[model samples]
Target: MELSELPSFDFESIIKSAVKKKDTHPVMDLPVDYEEFNLTSEFDRDSITAFVKSGGWAVGGYLEKRGVMYSAPRYADGRNIHMGIDIWAKAGEPVYAVLDGVVAYSTFQNDEGNYGGTLILKHMVEGQEIYALYGHLSKESLELHINGEKKKKGEVVGWLGEESENGNWPTHLHYQLCIEDPGEPDMPGVVAKENLIPARERYPDPRILLGDIY
Candidate 1:
């Protein structure tokens, strides 16, 4: 289906309502200038968790220096342009479906600085097929079902995973949207600087669906 043909979502209302009703942390309200913080600086998992717990989401990794986190050989040119929005919250916090869809993929990545337990849902909006990815989820999230399971909008799909199971990172949701399936339970959450334009075209800013939560 053409991208323009997809149905529009009430992103603002859905997100605002979700935040108000859930025990969400406000990431954008944090006092630190995340953009200027040294992305490559060494940080312990506990310290990172405490930072997010202090309140607000950290921003400014997209197409920037944060690429060090994904420096594996898989990432071309060691590029670190973040492609999704990371929602900071405590481990075990509930993550809900923003729309009705079927479970496309679910599995544990279990790699260093990886998504860990991830869930991908295949959604149909206005007859256009789209996909949503939720990463860093608890291992329990993978036990709930198998591929092709149907889910309803706002259903509790999973909870945040701890540092041990969530790629050794602080508890947070790595939320991303995709126009075309990447053919794996895992999708590229970050891209190379040279691929930024095309990647953006394929993976548009997830914050659109997330509303003002950023």
Candidate 2:
């Protein structure tokens, strides 16, 4: 089946439940622009948690100014192009599988500003293979299963992690979809602006599976 034809998760329902329980901030509210406001200094774990608690979830960081953080010695222009949809929520919120797939990778990144507890699932649909990456997850999520394990659609796969374990950022889920194998437990969540076109071809918009949240 085409990517668009793949099964999708009821992200709306999940957000509704979270809002009702006060586990999340209001739905559809955009996060403060880190670029315009120069909120980089407050990008640490504590500050991010406070921001999410007060503002709700953030969407649309693709090619955003906050991409400056990811730009580094690795890229001459800096990889400020965000490749996923970040769902900011309370730590420990349960993360469910979006489709039936096998665990492709599960591990901790341990980098200061990286995906701490990460999980990558691989799925084959209509002879085409695809992958999903769930980053900054709670450490406990890694222990829930082993590599190659089969995960049914909508299964409880893991939970959001606190700053201590989730790469020292605010508790959130970095979800991405890949058309090609990332070739590792982790994939580049950001790329340089110059490479946006090609990179986008490899990693299509995750909303294809996440549904519309805008």
Candidate 3:
């Protein structure tokens, strides 16, 4: 999983988890209510794509520059490939729960992309605890999430942030699927090349439940 190199997703492993956790799964019961960048001004979309393609400082880079090393540079490899999918969208956009779970971790990591404030929910489906991550959010999003508690299927966790706080590019949500305890209050939301094997093993691919979008 090099940053510039995309790897064939391990679907068999993903399927194994799905088969084992299908009944009462956290994500299955949770419904996604967020809006994708389906309506940015036509000009905006083109500009965003061009900027990211040019590749100076975009989504992952902003995080890296600030210190979230795991944003790129896979733990298994050094090319820095990304495993979690990033969906580009607009600011103030509504981000809802994709499943029912308790807010396990929430913080304003303003440190690196600091996830520009992030949230992680944990739950058990068919008995295994699973985690969900939401990143690059608006300031208000800081207050909107379920917090040290659980949220219903359609609750608005928060809105997307504008370019500035969201780490310089257009606003969007960087969601991930994790299987770890999500760390105490604060820890690495993204991992560098040193521990990716463990992260990927615990988290698996979120797209299996999220529906591939990158």
- Give me the displacement of residue 2 in model 3, in angstroms: 7.2
Q: Would you estimate the TM-scores of all the predictions? A: 0.74, 0.73, 0.63
> Model 2: clashing residue pairs?
none
Winner on TM-score (1 vs 3): 1
Top of the candidates by lDDT: 1
On a 0 to 100 scale, what is the lDDT of residue 118 in model 1? 94
Clashes of 2: 0
Q: Give each model's clash number.
A: 5, 0, 10
Query: What lDDT does each candidate get?
Result: 0.69, 0.68, 0.55
lDDT of 1 at 61: 36
User: What would the per-residue lDDT of candidate 2 be over residues 36-67, giving only the tens digit for each residue?
Assistant: 22332334546657866664555554334353
Q: Which scores greater on lDDT, model 1 or model 3?
A: 1
Tell me the deviation in Å of residue 124 in model 3.
1.5
Error of 1 at 187 (Å): 0.8
The full ranking of all candidates by lDDT, starting with the best, is 1, 2, 3
Looking at model 3, report the run of 10 residues with the lowest lDDT sum: 56-65
